[model samples]
Target: MSLRNNPKKSMKLPLTTRTNQVVRRKLQQSSGPFPRQSTNKPQRRPTRIRTTNPMQLLSNPAPNDRAEEQRKLRMAQNRLSSRNKRLKRRQLSRVAKIQHTSR
Candidate 1:
């Protein structure tokens, strides 16, 4: 027998497939358009212009190379020092914890 014939069974039974499809279609229509357009577009980088004098460009490389080498050396030293500082801090914290526990 159909669920409607019994009132108790009708109350417990889930919605029919036809009813579900109608509800889904209504929800989809209320949400947005049928063919959704993408909100985000790929970004294009600005093109670099080569406006420097060719003679100046050839002469400038030595100074730029020296500066770059010095910058790299400073960065490496800073990294090593920072690592040592972190290790020292961790050691101190462990020592403090041990002293606290012992006391």
Candidate 2:
């Protein structure tokens, strides 16, 4: 009952006749290596957007607003340094206490 031994009938066409038909059709529709018509267009360069000056905006800030911003910045720096100094003092005291207790 294998497929190779099965005896189903079929219609057969000659291979050379079929191949010639395909080749003739391909030759009729063949195109050149280079395109027949140019489809590409030249690209335009991009333009830069204009911007306003930052100093002008800062200069026009509401009265006292600029002064308040400067004060806040200075206070932030002071707090950072104070915290660092406090940490160093605590470390030194802890080392000193450890040395005294060990002796």
Candidate 3:
């Protein structure tokens, strides 16, 4: 009888064993995704830990010198000048609004 009509006759020979052997050989030759892990090897540690506070450097900063004092004075003068300019602009806008309303 034909092997198609009797699959048990095909398995009675070395055909099914040959296919299993070929599949096992292919699996051993190729490194699939699930490679066997070794318990003897230690796990890898991260290079750097990310749990540090970013503002720790600002907590203990450099000592203020004469250059720092000069910078502070310049910043204060700039703030005063900007405030005066803003007040002048507001006063001019208010005068223009009043003139327009009167007209």
Candidate 4:
């Protein structure tokens, strides 16, 4: 018997394919040109340009500007800890070597 003739076998199609077919048919019906409307909206206000020098702006920072300082402090602390770790490891290995040689 052919697969198309089998009623029980035809019921096993995925749910998503059936939903997509329905959505595509609905979209095809709604595809058309939009109706025109009035375009008399008021013009937007222009933004004020700052005439002050950028260097002056940086010299006098805004109130909420501690993020950069905090980041630099964290970076410096990380570097110091990493250096201390390396120094401690080198000293450990040197002491081990000296002990081995003296034995």
Candidate 5:
């Protein structure tokens, strides 16, 4: 007997992205007025990602153009970090003042 005829005995496949694509293709083929497939290629998730230290950024730069872009991003990151530190300091000082005033 064909696997499709026996739903309970059908092969159990993992719900992977490729499996999803196959299922969708089958569904579109069976239905009338099938929805248009997206023109954009599906973005596959990266299998492996690399980790690098943020502080090592300036020391280990990219190619000239990319290096410049990295510099700009680093500077922006530094400014934001400093701004956050200042805000935290102010918050702590306010709490300290409230405690001192109440004592």
Candidate 6:
């Protein structure tokens, strides 16, 4: 089970300086840390959701300027409509999923 006394085996290398140089050369040749392409480009993190309050807009009376009031009203309406559309779509999808699973 022991090869310590074996004539074929040796613990120390005869050419340590040459071996160290070869190892150093191989290490230098290898790409350091990360690939060149990855180093050139940076990664983008996910962005947070934008916040809007329809209730707050509705609660506060519009400004006296007719044009500005109209624009604000239109924007609020668009936001509410889009939110409703998304909710309705989600509900419809859930219903469809239930029906599919029942079948």
lDDT top scorer:
1
Q: What's the true lDDT of residue 3 in model 5?
A: 67
Poorest 10 consecutive residues of model 4 by lDDT?
Answer: 32-41
TM-score of each: 0.41, 0.39, 0.38, 0.39, 0.40, 0.37
lDDT of 6 by residue, 1-103 (tens): 2456764544344688658877888879987654666688877888644335766555553455456888888999999999999999999999999999999
Off by over 4 Å in 3: 1-64
Best by TM-score: 1
Better of 1 and 6 by TM-score: 1
Which model is ahead, 2 or 5, in terms of lDDT?
A: 5
Please, what are the lDDT tens digits per residue for candidate 4 over residues 1-103? 7669998766666789768887788768866532332355457899655447878657655545556767888999999999999999999999999999999
1-103 in candidate 5: lDDT tens per residue?
7767987655454558658888789888785534455545579997643337765644554469477887899999999999999999999999999999999
Give the lDDT of residue 74 in candidate 2: 97
TM-score comparison, 1 vs 3, better candidate: 1
lDDT, residue 86, model 5: 100
Residue 75, candidate 2: C-alpha displacement in angstroms: 0.8
Please report, in order, the local distance difference test score of every candidate based on alpha carbons. 0.77, 0.72, 0.76, 0.76, 0.75, 0.74
Poorest 10 consecutive residues by lDDT, candidate 1: 33-42
Q: Please give the lDDT score at residue 103 for candidate 3.
A: 100
lDDT of 1 at 9: 75
Q: Which portions of model 2 show Cα errors greater than 4 Å?
A: 1-63
Question: Against the hidden true structure, what lDDT does model 2 obtain?
Answer: 0.72
